[model samples]
Target: MTRTRKAMVLGAAALVSALTLAGCSPAAQNDDSSNATTYTQDEIDKALSTPTELTFWTWVPDVQKEVDLFEAKYPNIKVTVVNTTGGTQQYPKLRAAIKAGEGAPDVAQIEYQYLSSFRQTGSLSDLTQFGADEHKSDYVDWIWNQVADDKGVWAVPQDSGPMGNLYRTDIWAAAGLEGPPSTWDEFAEQAAEIRSKTDSYIADLPGNDPGQMMGLFWQAGAKPFSYDGDKTVSINLNSPEATKVVAFWQDLIQKDLVATDPDFADEWYQGLARGKYASWQVAAWGPLFLQGTAKDTSGLWNAAKLPQWNAGEDVSGNWGGSTDAVLAGSDNQIAAYELAKFINTDEESALLLANDQFLFPTTTATLKNPDFVDQESEFYGGQKVNEFFAGVSTTVDKDFQWLPFMDFVYSSYNETVGAAISDKADMVSALDDWQNAVQEYATQQGFTVQ
Candidate 1:
């Protein structure tokens, strides 16, 4: 999930067109350097003690606080922080650097969905070979799974977004509801009640957000997209499970229980401020965002688990989160991997990432710590929103996957399913159109779409 502060989309053309490569030979493509994978304790010590300089590219603000911890622990290694534009902008520039054989950072922040794309270029180092796999037990299962595949572990889990329901407690109270809905049936019933009684929508289903739509599909256990970081892939946007999800939302939109509004815009912000919408199905990162965007609604909200699909089951889908990956061409793989791991896993760094930078925690140590989860939010009616979301984190499905070409997938989704959503058309048929467009694009991209 892209935080409100970061760019939500990446454009490949921006990367290609922005480059002014100087004196680079056409043969200088995909610089797969001879970086070592494993290191002895002595080797690590020697590496850290050496006069080394490393570059890190990330979009997180105030990230220097975390970087300083690493530098303090290993004084000889100095890290240069670069605010590489996130989403489409970050990856293309990274790829350009690898092709140019220079100016690439030793470590780069990568979203889970885009990691496969970098892996496809063979430009990310396999962290598994450097003792990274041992930390698999340290992270949340879904997050650890995101950075690994059949090939190897490519990155360290930084932060994650396990989806949850955030609602206006006063609106629910006005509707004679005491807590969040336990099922979609209850949710819809409450939607009708909230609208009828209070003139407020249950939520806004943004027509432009494929990530949100995909997260819902993921929650339903629909494996709609998959790629091998190579030639083989799968697309099942029209699967029975996915159809069930699409149809559910279609019914809601048609009934006028929810609003059709694109998010991250002034109108959307105003909706939150004016209480036009009563609830948001958002990632853990959303509470801090909502506090800043909807200050007038402070203390009127509460957090809870997303409504269950099955009567008594618990499950969730992730909307946004990212990792720190060491590039394959880094001359200092030992230092790079250590830096990525340290910032994410070290207690001081991880806490600072959560408390200071507002990144939702991925490490179990940080996720469950009373220091992180025990605090009540003034904006959420004194609810321990972090604790609520931490509980939701445990229920996330561990098997969600993404296409390597998610940039295209999301763009295409906005054009097809999103358009239908906005126009109040037949979403079931729109799903078919989305399926066809994605399948055709996958085939055109030379993938063996299954």
Candidate 2:
């Protein structure tokens, strides 16, 4: 939910030049920010009743159920939901449509990481125009904050992926272990002991997924990147706190106590099913993903919060989450807003997303619903997995943010830091290289580095 906390940007003599290359000038953003168009209830009713059409771009499969609910309620407004390839593939097409001045949808699904980039280009409609700020209480504080900044509410909260550790209690019980560790110091001790005693490593760090690593950094309160939703940018992958994470994993990787495997591949999926790893440090969405991936090991798994940097800390971090943002280019503003608002805030539609689609909830009301959280899982010894992660969602660090040019940042990381991890090389040194590369990219892209 954190937009930013630390001052991480470097200064240019003045704010300038690259974002304008995309045609979003500072003046345009000022117009977007200052013009909060509040509508009367009559205006809202008329907009909903008018025969209007909206194109919605999303990657969520079978989300049409929610859209159907919105259509049934509005009767006059018709929505066409267009599913795209998830983020990496979808974002470029979205940007291209904006540049070409056509083909972009009225409402689009956007991850928290990419929200800053679209916001930088002035491509997102300010939901504040329709009094979006008033519904802030509907979501968890941290999740709500990620969709908002001083500019305006950029998106409607949809789903979230707060991180937690899912471990094999059966594996630990064989060594007389009762539960997961409370602190990372204890985790390391157990990781080594488990490797020495069993056939499994405690977990495999994903060498290819920086998002998972960033979630770890978030838990440690490292300020990896910061942008003011304008020209100023900051990056510090090698910050003292973040370096601790790099060094700690380095020790485990070098000692052969943890495996750095490319995630979401055939070999990785096999590793999970066969118990090559005893735990997964994954997002709230992970429990269900693991359930389906490791059906052979049903009733052997359990969930817990990530081990803290210091004992007794209740901090966690988010790995994935998305919002429904209406594009600023849309002609159907009110209808678009209604479609976004309905799927997320309407209890039936929201709960349908949770119960049927298995998208982890962002709305606090849905998160607290007894029917949503009280369910037991036969796959994890009847544990109330939703109840556990719903609590974890509340503990996620509230000040984390992303760079506006994260597309480049993420690709570059795979070559530098991610490459080093796969080679089992010095992550601390690699962090420095990643830092230099990102800073150089920022300057070349015309941001005022902080």
Candidate 3:
């Protein structure tokens, strides 16, 4: 899970300011190429060497260790790290600053889902002009796409949250099961067995969790959303592929094989510690979190890739992660880009991000490094937790996209799909409600919906 629940942004005042700043977004996307004014290596070198200060806003604690590496390489550059009170409140402040034409950081932390919301307000820079493309091969392909498009590279991927299954091995043994199920059909069978044998439910699904739902849909190859770097969007929440996934969850929930519990809450923590849930359909960050909350259950746990729609497939989706993006309006674009790139690509700095900040690694070097991935976790019965997740990162689909008004898309899920799940209503038909709500909102926001 992310630091915050992708916290409430686009509040009333922020929304009004965003409206005031309308047309600054996609309509002017042509500025991407027009502003792609080439820069020589010497220019970038000079910019980094010159005395400059870059303000960076992020909530990652002790990120200064990584930033220090950047400053050491370019002694002339100093960076000020500001805590934006976490991701939930960060975007509103970011929007307000952009509206005032001041106080915005040179480099800022932005989540993949909210990147387009910022793009919709023309708040992010086209990092393509800063040679961001040169490092394209360094990051996982799917995550790289989240920050780059045909128009420009918006950010350098710092980390990712590939989905996986963290289960109680002892619980499986109690149910006479070998291990995690390889397919959805097998998962249901195991869920039933696990329930009959113990007090534990198979897993907990949060009715309020849009991130988890979106990730699962992504794994199933549901193209529910797309944007054209402009006002045009395609919203297809009711697609058959996505509906099938939801329908399966609906079946499990109604059958009492799964518990509809509010996750990341005190009760959920208790559930894990008390062995009330047999497994957690969690992201890469989850095992570590479980280690913290379920410390007593350490030796009893193991993790695996998410159960595939097909028996033999290895596929997953992402839930939480963030990136460093330069502001489009910052005068120090060159220096800012250098700072962003160094913090993520430099092996030492990047590893510090994973090891210290507890952010998952996105760079291929860190993902492959034995030192990073091969650490056996006693908490996981000596499983190489990072290695398992790093493998899951490779299986993530490369083509998932987000709608610009993701805040609404998420909130709408709470009203329609989430509500339906909580009510134990028809999950497949809830997609129709979700689709209609999204399309209606998209049209109202002046988007050309497809």
Candidate 4:
């Protein structure tokens, strides 16, 4: 069946009254009668005694294995797994379920990009009372902060899409470059050399992707938006840092050293597989897409740290990733928290890495484990890819924050800014239009846009 149909079917089966409990903490399930306000153990036992079931929604392929394990350990608790389709479709379903008030999943996987929006809508449960306090020591401070608000926590840290550069060794070798470039200047020099020495392009720059520009801007410490708990501030896209990033990309295109692909289509995928482009900027989960789309280039690919800015330190940034959150309305909040905690912590992280090659857990302890260091990936020339990623994860900046109107900002920015890159519009004009559009869109969404 189609992915959407599967999601609908699972959502239907898991929406029954007994399974309709909203958000609570994993600790709530273990509480005694004395702490009944927080869902004491007696209440959970009574609820479970009657064969309580929970619905879980996720898009990650690795989560299925964990669900199977969770089921085996708790045979009495039934779980229905729903795999949501595109982000555009998934959010509406969640919104509808929240509105209906009785059919939402006990837990749902949400992207970091949407955390602020979800929290604003009051769809998630406060996890602070669920015992996240004690376990907070186990996670990275930045990750914990990602899901927490002034009131309480919304979700447990799952995986991180720590950014890196994936390159084709063969392509670099053919271009007479010794290795991947380490700094922005070096990268530009090498790209020019590669174009001059060979027929292949250095990389595929999707002109329509503001996210790519955002990553570059982030490397220079520019944030699209900032929050002061009560108000949001917009960073000017015409700022020097943003201009530098856009200028560099424009030069690359003008020099004809990079291919200006509109999006990740068959042509782009095939080009990567055939070594037409030497490298691409990606995050931890990107390997999965490469594995599925470029099966033929198994051992040719390898990953390295992204090139540093001319004046910045050589640190990595994050791209895209999802986190798991318990619903405020879930009846089995305690049980759900337990599952969320286990999956996000060190032990389950190692298991996830071993089982699915793509997941890079955010827990520092998991990264330090021998299993993480020793594991080898055949797809990456038998490299201990996880170990390298683990070493880099610690240095990733946690200060990078997401805004409530990120979806609207990114969608509009990409389309407009992308037009400039494609030579369809003037850069200044495009950016001005983008900024105005974002302000208007955010205002419509009830956000105080500047």
Candidate 5:
């Protein structure tokens, strides 16, 4: 799940500040030749050798280990690491700094959903100018598209969270199930059996996680939100595809086959330990998180593909992951880009990010490396968790897109659709409320709602 930062409902004053700051930043004047800018090996070496200090903003703990590798390679370059909090707290501060034309970091951690939001401000530097395209084939396609577009490459893919199912084998066995469900119809039958025989709910569908719910929509090929990278966007949250997804969950919830609980809380954590949840319909990060939070469950669990809407279709979506992006206002673009690229692509740094930090691998080299993916996890009965997730990552759709106002989009879900889930009310009506609320917000933000 995308971590929610604590903040009161953003008022109109804050929205106005953001809108004004977005408009005030200078637009990049790009020529055809500018888009094709590339650095030769000698030129890159020269730039890395020059004395420079790059300020990087991120919340990943102990990322200094990766930065140190970059510094070791380019002894003349020093990076100042700053944890300006994450998404919610960081965006306002970054916007203020950009408006003041001072104090913004040279590089920052930006999640895929928010890339377009930052791009709207005209603040992110085009990384294609720094030769980012040269490494395009190194990353997973969905992740590469998150940071690059027809306009420019915005950042390098650092990590990703492809959706999958992590379930308890023991629970399914007790329910007389032979294997994981391949289709949603089979999943519903298993959910009913598990609840009746094993006394365990199939999963905890969070009452508040729009990102997770949206990931399911994505897996079903619902193009609910689309942005044109300009002022025009298409918002269709209540589409037929979206309704089918919601209705299926509504049936399960109403039948008591699934638990409606807030995730990432102590209660949810305890649910895993106590065997209250039979499975978690979560992202690639869920396996590692489960190992850390519910160590007692050790050998009882296993990984599988998400239950398909169409029996044989292989498809999934992302929930949480981020990239390191350089700002347009940075005077040290070349040095900053080098620092961003080094930590994610260099063998030593990439391995550290995967094994040490437990961020899912994005680079194909790291994904294929046996040392990275074949290692046994004691928590999952020596299962090669990374290998399973790496295989699942290949099923993610490459064409999914996001609206620029994801912050608002998510918060609105918690207020409207999430509220409905908690009340066990009509979810179809809730979807309509969500659609209207999003459309109104987009229009208010000066976006031409399509």
Candidate 6:
């Protein structure tokens, strides 16, 4: 999602030189140039005689089907895909590629979290001038907003991870709870009862993972930043809603009602499978991970709405997912736009939905499709998970935007906050350190930190 822009700069310089030379020639520069450049059917046929090759980089496992389809449709265009390895490593690699000025790929999969950072680099092509406007109505407003810069649209939203609670039904039943808790209070009560009655903890609080905690804050209507146009104003992390939410999470751990585990280890996956943890606060992608990690648990798991902040409706959170962006230096801008449109629009919705790709399509028409509504999954006892996810998607807020420094901030916050949860640091000091570290990082990244 992030690029160095060194390659883009060099490419721009070369283009400027070419344009300048062409302009100097009397025959090359003329008022009738636009008219003369129009390609006839014969000319178009000649152009298609030689295929254009494009390189695509993506992290999504479901992208293969789309790639195959695209190759089939445009035999003249060769599409080569490279799978991304790590989420954090993606941006840095992109940055380095741009710096090297030679290894940059034609198209890259960019996650929503890193979109702001990518846009700030000014290396991505704005698809608006190249026919993206025609498909504007096809995507959700919020998803479109994620890719739009002040100049124009930067990417196509391929998919999103709508929030949900994936829990073990057997564990809830054992705790004397009939169904998933609807409110935070009910969730807390159930957690307490579950802890007292059963050996399994209600959830695992991996202190290093700030995603669940951030989700809790957003569900309580707290935002880390407020934007007016392009300017951003930092919001108080100690706001009443944030404090209450933090306290709720802290109290669960402090009261021994939730299992505190180390982040990203064999123990975490093993614990989840053995029902040492009862539920997970995750997005639609949770089922995919569960399918691989908890295969033995089979029919024991089910999906539910995330717990509301104070027993109200409309409670959900956005998590990890990638979008596609075209580079500004691309020679085949029109071709790139066409491919982007094909994936994000209605063309691939059925395949995306059927594959359990966790792609909650942004297009409203795609949502209205019977294929989306009638979709059934054997994973959750054939309960029509897509319908449940569609309901959650409506609550996503357009105003919620991530900061360019989110990666830096979140990385530091997790470390500091994790220490606090592990009893190695106090909450007040940890939060103070987290804020100071983020501000310093922002400064280092050339931001005017206040």
lDDT of 1 by residue, 1-450 (tens): 212212211232234334524332342222322132344567677888898999999999879889999999999999999987576678888889999999999999999988988888888999865778878889888888899877789999888889988899998999888788999888888889998999799999999999888888889999998888788999999999999988988999999988989999999999988999999999999999999999988889888888888889999999988999999899998899899999999998999899888899999999988889999998887888888888999989999888888888899888888998899889899999999998998899888988
Query: Which candidate should be chosen as best, given TM-score against the real structure?
Result: 2
List per-prediction Cα lDDT, in the order shown: 0.86, 0.89, 0.87, 0.71, 0.86, 0.70
Per-residue error for 202 in candidate 3, Å, reads 0.4
Model 1 off-target regions past 4 Å?
A: 1-37
What is the model-wide C-alpha lDDT for candidate 2?
0.89
Best-fitting candidate, measured by lDDT?
2
The better-scoring model by lDDT among 2 and 3 is 2
**Which parts of model 5 have CA positions greater than 4 angstroms off?**
1-36, 39-43
Q: Which lDDT value does model 2 have at 317?
A: 91
How many steric overlaps are in each model, in order? 3, 5, 0, 14, 1, 1
Positional deviation of residue 148's Cα in model 3 after best superposition, in angstroms = 1.2
Measured over all alpha carbons after superposition, the RMSD of each candidate to the real structure, in angstroms, is 9.5, 8.2, 9.3, 9.1, 9.8, 6.2
Q: Summarize candidate 5's per-residue lDDT along 149-256 as a digit string, tens digits.
A: 887898878889999998999888998999888988998998999999987999988888898998899888888988888899999999998999999999999998
Q: Model 6: what TM-score? A: 0.84
Q: Find the 10 residues in a row with the least total lDDT in model 6.
A: 31-40
> What's the distance in Å from true for residue 5, model 5?
45
Output the worst ten-in-a-row residue range by lDDT, candidate 5: 1-10
Cα lDDT for residue 313, candidate 4: 73
Candidate 3 lDDT trough over 10 residues, lowest sum: 1-10
Model 3 lDDT on a 0 to 1 scale: 0.87
TM-score of 3: 0.91
lDDT for 235 (candidate 1):
93
lDDT tens readout by residue for model 4, 82-192: 888545667778878988898888888887767777777777867765557656767666566677755677788777777788888887898898999888789899999
Worst lDDT run of 10 residues, candidate 4, spans: 27-36
